[model samples]
Target chain A: MSVTTIAPPANPVERFLRTDRMPHIWCPGCGIGTTVNCFTRALIDAKIDLDHLAIVSGIGCSGRVAGYVRLDSFHTTHGRAIPFATGLKLANPKLQVVVYSGDGDLAAIGGNHLIHAARRNVDLKVICVNNLIYAMTGGQTAPTTPGQVVTSTNPYGTFDTSFNLPHLVEAAGAVYVARWTTYHVRQLSRAIAEIFQKPGFSFIEIISPCPTLYQRRNKMGDGLDTMKYYKEKSKVKNGAPTSEVGLDKQGEIIVGKFVDRARPDYRELMVNQMHESLGSRFIDPVAAECEEGEPQGCEEGLCS
Target chain B: MNADPRGVLSGTHFLDGDHACCEGALAAGARFSAGYPITPSTEIVERFSSRIPTVGGTFIQMEDELAASIAIQGAVWGGAKAFTVTSGPGFSLMMEHIGYAVMTETPCVFIDVQRGGPSTGLPTLPAQSDMMQARWGSHGDYSLIALSPNSPQECFDLTITAFNLSERYRTPVMLMMDEVVGHMTEKVVIPEADKIEVEPRRHTKKSPAEFLPYEPAEDGVPEMVHAGEGFRFHVTGLTHDERGYPSMTPQTQDKLVRRLRSKIDGANRQIGLYEAEGLDDAEVVVVSYGITSRVAQRAIELARVRGIRVGKLRLITVWPFPEQLIRTLAKRVTAFVVPELNLGQVVLEIERSAGSHAHTISVPHAGGNVHRPEQILDAILEAAK
Candidate 1:
């Protein structure tokens, strides 16, 4: 069988995408590209109005995802994407705010934001790319780098325990929590699409490969070999215990959907609170004008 | 300050520094305040949270400083003048968002009631160590407008000023108050609403469809559009073009950085708000800001009575350091005395700006106790002789 080469579609979705700066600074065969593809596909699949989608990302290769998206995106400070996304979402609940970040960017430095957003169940989606190592700064040891892994910072091997992200998300009360690998493109894309469809705080952790950093140092070969490892290792069973999945020095990877549920979202709660506080005045023009000048009134002691 | 002839309003009352800042934000029309309570600054948040809702604004106790800062940013984008208050550790957490506000050109106010720290040192005590951090803490080469208040009245006045400058410049303005000013109680007259000049944001007259959020106008400040207004501009941490999309080209990066730097720097003349006392034909100048400046003013009087040539230069806007004024003073004065609560922070800026023309000395303290007027007077007398 031969694969047919067809001319690219005019007004290709990729054209609306940010592409002039590529080839991206990401390493060759980096999972970031696959994750980006999945995200764009998910966005397209959901048929979300692109004008109303706000993609926010923090510092890291994964953080660069926002820059490549066609929507109103914010590439914020290191480990600060969740909070930035939270602000974007709260400012205009009409917009879909999605956070694209790396494990270190989200779980490590931005750990507080992730847990709080989940606890509050803010109306946002966080697609965390867990490449295990901090790939952007030449593979420094990261919060997700498994025990005994060696990197530039952890030259003597990592003694620090790694974060179990899906469990953390689940524990933090994320309405949706799932894990998938770049190898499972269709599954990953589908997971992103589904998570985007849900309202509350949905979290999708993508277990991606860091070929240049994690692979080369850990002897996982190149990108193809890494994907193959993921292909062989990942268990498709739902709700499998994390302990059930293990890896040898050169072993199989594990990936699958973990959790899906529902809870009261932050936006709905905020609107309810606003209505209760304002009563019938909530819809009054005078109250609306008062809302506009309320800050000044508070300072003047009139409101206090 | 004299009370207005009109009877005190129902909600008006004599309050402390922290409460006054809250009042100032309210007066200047801050509709949202999101903050994680920290010492000295906590009262501001507590009072704001309780009072904001009554006024039809929102006060959110965010999970942390990071969230708090971002929440306020969201409120500002929602078309509300918003603010957050924190101290030391919380300020450190807010540094990243401060950079965000600068990059996105969002108008907001950050009140850092500074405390002693490398970590969480002296939460209750006063310290001005965050002054330098306020100027350049966020890992970028951008200019900011930071104001320090010397009294409770100034605290109230400057908090309102901070928001005004924020809206005027389309950048985050830092209210760098310390523990003393943040907690000290004093009488502050609540001015009539109409008497206060509240500057609404410089909204683009051009339709939202034609708006480029990051494009600088002739005044060097970019026009801002609220999120629901249908502007299609992007906001990013990366060096971006006028359209707000990431632009990696050297020329584009240069323009972005230059515009960010120049917006505040170019407006330095107008934004270099300060107060000078007794500087004409004086040989000794005592430079100070925030609460310590009050003590410095008293010290100047003592030195004057003692037959010493003494003057005072109080910095109102600290970030765009009043270098032009400092240079002129340095040429005329034999020495500059800088008295601050922190152990020699702003003194460094004073010394640098003074260059080789004047001898600069620091009267540093960590603020468990206030600097003595006699001590500063003695320094002035020595400098004069």
Candidate 2:
């Protein structure tokens, strides 16, 4: 018989990942990995400079993203990633900072930071992977957990109203907001790419599958079944009012670019106000002392 | 290294300890600060907010102390010297981030204008109750440098020293100021920037290929590469290896924790700073720090007039404890009288170091106010007997 020749599948995005840190802590059929794949693809599509990019994450399954990324990364303490990224972005305006974390991390313990960062319209790209449960800590109830879902903490079923994430952030003054499920990889990747072009606070919520804790406990079949359900239920309504986009248990999912508008980001507002007030004496703080050969040049290790 | 002259307010000025601390931070090349409004400490940030824009820096009033504490670390990694200011309640909120700073080896400063508190007990009053909390507040075994400033002048001078020590060691340094010193006004002479010696960050000369983020050099301190110069290094709060990647094994944890402590402990002599006076011939040696030290100075003078040979050991840097000096003095002195604004904090260290070589006496104060001179002199008189 003639010998059959086949080429190995190309994984071009491997350079963007810390392959040495793999196999990651993510379990089998977890949607976090899928979202990461889309993120890497978006970075490529956006042609973002990998050198000037930094990833910050808080405590959760998704917080491990910082450790697995082959870039300037920080795995900060619980709920503090947004403020940490805020400092990074404000300190070095040349660098693009991203805060990547989970539902419980971004919406529960970190909820205050989430709204405030958006309110400031800090130039940060925030990716919140909403798996509807605290998967890493054995499926505890998250602030975003849909109503009547059986979580570890809410075994009798969750009674409180869940957060409408897009609405919350949009109302808090985010410049761009979008929602997509893991089933919509192309759409998610495009949305992330669009975020790179936006100047102010941009947020993308990815509804992901947690097969081990969330799906297994809720008897929602397996990861594949969840994906099929997502494929069937999601309805794209671009620029739809974010107030009506709340998710519910076994309900229709509104998925699309819900909010995209313009507002001067934190830096822009700061620059304008300072320039207007100080006039001739105004100094661009971001470019101030760090440049080489300047009066306060930070190049010769002087900044510390 | 000389500081940037632009940040220096090079002249004598009447200022409070809080404002003086702010001027000191500017002169030390701190280009970024994040803080929340807190009693006694708010003036530092208030001055920084207005002063930073003109001096080419950024000062953000974060949502709370938790954000303010860690934001400074983020700025440090972004290639700027940064700090935060707070009091007891805010300092308590910052313990977790302080641990994060230790684990990541991010060099920064935390100025705690201390107030009385187990929990917000005295917001506007002076207290040194948080001294132990400064050393052991974060839930982990770690060592840090702490400086106690007794006056506005020391606030300016020691604030610069705090920044220098933090840079040299690559660890968080605490400028422990009680509300008395934080709010007290006095003449602060700010020297020219070129005259102010500042320690530069230990940036790695090695290329990205050769550099490992957590690799310690000959001095047991790692070289740093801030975010965005293409180093692409990683920093985490978890137990990590020299590569700065998390490794959860017990072996990694042991090695990391031991090194974090040993780095500062090995250089304790170089780090310990204090003023020893009249110890050559003395029966009772008084140990004190912060505002209480100033009060103790008066007590020593009074004790000397009362025919008791009293000596003073003023601790400028309190955390590394100056155990060598305490141990040496304990050998000859009849007793050690330790007075503090707190009930009994640093006195415990004196008791531990003296360990039957000398009598250890705790002149405790409940801490709504500074100790009266007679209160310490009474203790000194008792110790002499």
Candidate 3:
């Protein structure tokens, strides 16, 4: 008997990507695609049920990650990816939910949800690609763009103070917080793997390049040049207080695992509290809780 | 499919409209809800958060209505029946997601227990003012299903209907309740799990290798496969072909947008729900919905008692607006009187349906409580005259 052997895929990374949709919409020398490459690598390395993996992204260049990945993904509305993932995770706790989006979608328009998700410590992995500008809408000003940076909306140079994201998420109660650039692919991918298992809110901010508009207008050089700059300027300080980790326009970019703590995620706290309050009368509503009747030991005004 | 017995509380009980609406959601197969509570609508989620843990689902008190609205859509894509509840102001905040849901052809429910509002006008009061908003609030030329339940029982009944229609058509269904209906307590008999029919998710049967996410069946409705089901498909709010990728040509826009309308519009006849009484040779008719329907019922009784040839048409499905019925009745009736808690909303639909065949009168109220039956009676008398 003769057996036929199939040839191995030439580009291993293509297995995790929707390569047919490529050449992606990302501009030349853009760092989003590079960051996504790291993400797909991390997702593969995590070694979980690929069938149960779900990726959610908001509106932006980074939001395109959800579309490119080979998992069950959602390119949700602007600034709402966190909440959407929140619902998806709570609905099916077994889903390995990941939220990937841009800084503007996460910190600017979706800032409220960002903080509250961290505060609630919802169990999910957030990969925020901070390109320092809103690259999709023609390089507009973003909440993460460093001070005095020029964007379409800020042609006269930005006057608004940017958010210190590592500090923000830590303050908001994320269990794991890390920062990396596309230059730090190995570290970023490693953090990505770690975040998958870290319960509660886990945020990974990848400072990436927007050579098309942001770099051209600001004269920050092309993607590779910016990557070289990140290599020289980034100082890895794992375990440093997040407060000491703000990125300066011309100063060092502090990149590391800044915060990792043990705390109950939203589902854990919610389920535990529900069990404590409602006892055995309560079950996961999606499980076997469909039948209805008066409870044996009912509290006034409860579901019974 | 029948409701899961555990989620279905099969017995008669005294409950408010808000609680009944929540029960209806459970029976309809909704096991996930993301909500930020507002007056009159809070109890729906409050009860859901408690009951869902027992029945086997999850509820999150979202940071705001924006999160609440989109979160449910995410859950839907994650393979769960999901919904969110809010009032007028929260509904306004949710308009963007509603439009997104329409564009993406996601099946979910939006419960708007409306309060008086131009902008939070009456948080604790009743109003049907959102009738127009529910129809056209989301930007773009598209059609959706909107249901109005008059009593606590209908709140349960119509909520299930909303979910069924949403699943059947793969569109977001709106359950429009007023503070009056949401807060009022009454006897509601929930049926056994198997007795209640729900439209299960129309999942695609073809293997993942051959599936096109947005490709509809002959009925102009598409099948949905949840995320994590190994169906590698992309869905966006952008205009796309069957594969659900972004396509920006006017041709794509025309084909896509037209199909969005035609699905619900094509089914408008079947989708339209209303109650008709005493229209054989009636000279005048009263059209109302939600709480105003009940009030109009009272005025209708009085009008018949006074020998005014008046009839009642209570709208259950407000959108797709029972137009054929209104148009046919318009030909026979002297006039149509619309009494609403709003200044004027659904009356416009009636007028359009009536055209010049019959006079259309609107009995508008600013909506703190409800329309006084006498006010509706007076309007009927005037329209009759």
Candidate 4:
């Protein structure tokens, strides 16, 4: 008869997660959980204001990041996370807003927003998990699904060429652009943390496994196999030109921080333009939040 | 709740409904807007984009209506009074986010300066075609507020009301306009900032540890908190529990759906805003809204001169349908005449509410323009007989 009170597992990442809703919807050997684990580590290491951090996600398996992250987060409508995060950052420039979504969510239906968000240089950290297929709605052909890859919709294999996201973001004016995989956990975390200090749009594309559908159909085995493949084939070439860093059809994952430069984010540009146009009368909406006597904007329903 | 004097124009100016709507949003403390420029509704955001910088907010021209709609929701969470304006095509695109706002109980406004559609049927012309769409375009079982303004002045007035109702209800409020009103120019007085009463975002006073994001107050509206203020609450479009965590169970779905329905349905009486005239011993009642209400007013006058005892009920708040008023009036009036720019949308609700008590007649007009006073007068005269 042994009556012993055992303590819970002292996992550091548990604090950042809504473990009450654990045993997530992701399939066995899913890489999304690994991405989340890396992100949590990045958040912890960044040592930024957790309260000021707000995560926005679109509809997908990766979109569940907002639900799990113990932060001011929003799981918005599909493919609108970038613009939503743009609004969040612009509305309150003090907020460290992040858009975490999937390839189907970000690069397909959300592609326009992704490019425009980059163009505007909205201060947002965007983490796009590319499983190379629409895993949530079944193995539908995603914009990132490599050519000749068979999907639910494309049994004949997709003819469309996949987007090189790091190149796309860099070309669209992102101040920071990086690519990593679930296998590159430490580098991904460091890269994610580095982007925390950078201004303007920062993008990190995580190439992950879709074992249940993508791997099963493609005959690429499971997530562990994908991780092993990444470990063996992934090339880390930091500061490589974005144009030349695109993934090859031969399964060589070109992983690196391809671009990092200084640029005024959307808020700074707005504030500057407003100061020039409206002069002293331009009571910055973000600044207005800190004023004591100047009719507090967030009262009642006036959001800020 | 006075508006920030800086944002308020605070003077009389000849303005169109679209422009007036913009000023109204500004006066009501809207500091952020995300929009896609579409016909009729473009002027609202066009004016807002230029004016917002002066007033200290953000105006983002999103790539599409879907992004625009959801962007405002994010801005709302980030502590900004936010909105988006669009025409019919854009409205259709925004339907998804409208449902999302309802599901998440986020406060925002969507101004639809309606153009003819079934698929871009008329981009530049007026239509009341989206009346039913405004009420039910968004999927799922949730209730929302919709207001119609007849004149540029009412446009200014009701846009503020729409924002206030959105704040009070914690739902996306629709400002349903037509091309005529949206494009028509008229004198609109911008009231003093202190004179305009605006509802402050009802922020939760409870500490973050004690707060449940979806937990409702007596009014069935949960108090809100903005992002970056240390309230690490979650909001989603999914069926969520009081903690704002998604719950897919039947019990959770039933509780959430019922509350969504009852919150607006039960408060229809209080939410209803309409003007009723000539009800006593009236043989006919003319029911209309938006620009049609103006034409209906003329028709009601012409019918009165013709000795037709026609009463007028000009609806200002359209959704939640003012069902009780229509039912009660049906018991008294001999007949009810509904004239709308669209062919029989709100008329369906009118007929349903009238039931067997009164004869319901719809004077339908298919898009492109407002009804001729004669057409409505003829309906009123026929109903009176």
Q: Rate the local accuracy (lDDT) of all candidates.
A: 0.80, 0.92, 0.87, 0.88
Q: What are the per-model DockQ values?
A: 0.30, 0.78, 0.57, 0.71
**Predicted structure with the largest lDDT when compared to the true one:** 2
lDDT per residue (tens digit) for residues B276-378 in model 3: 8888978999988888888889999998899998888888999867888889999989999999898988999899999999999999998899878999999
Retained native contacts per candidate, as fractions? 0.37, 0.76, 0.70, 0.82
On residues A200-283, what C-alpha lDDT tens digit does candidate 2 reach at each position? 999999999999998888999899999999999999999989999999999999999998899999987888898899986876
Which digits, one per residue and each the tens of the lDDT, describe model 4 over residues B158-267? Answer: 99999998998888999999999998999999989999999999998999989889898897888998897788889898899999999999999999989887888888
lDDT assessment of candidate 2: 0.92
Q: Count backbone clashes in candidate 1.
A: 8
Return the candidate ranking by lDDT, descending: 2, 4, 3, 1
Question: C-alpha displacement of B99 in model 4, angstroms?
Answer: 0.5
The number of the candidate with the highest DockQ is 2
Q: After superposition, which runs of candidate 2 have C-alpha atoms over 4 Å from their true positions?
A: A1-9, A294-304
Superposed model 1: Cα runs more than 4 Å off: A1-7, A147-160, A239-256, A270-304, B1-11, B74-80, B205-213, B226-231, B247-254, B281-283, B306-310, B330-335, B354-361
What range of 10 consecutive residues in model 1 chain A has the weakest lDDT sum?
A295-304
**Chain A TM-score of candidate 1 vs. true chain A:** 0.86
Itemize residue pairs with steric clashes in candidate 2.
none
- Flag regions of model 3 displaced more than 4 Å: A1-9, A285-304
Minimal lDDT window, size 10, model 3 chain B: B226-235
Better of 1 and 2 by lDDT: 2
lDDT of 1 by residue, B64-103 (tens): 8988998788767656788999999999988988998998
- Reference-based lDDT, residue A96, model 4: 82
How does residue B94 of candidate 1 score in lDDT? Answer: 89
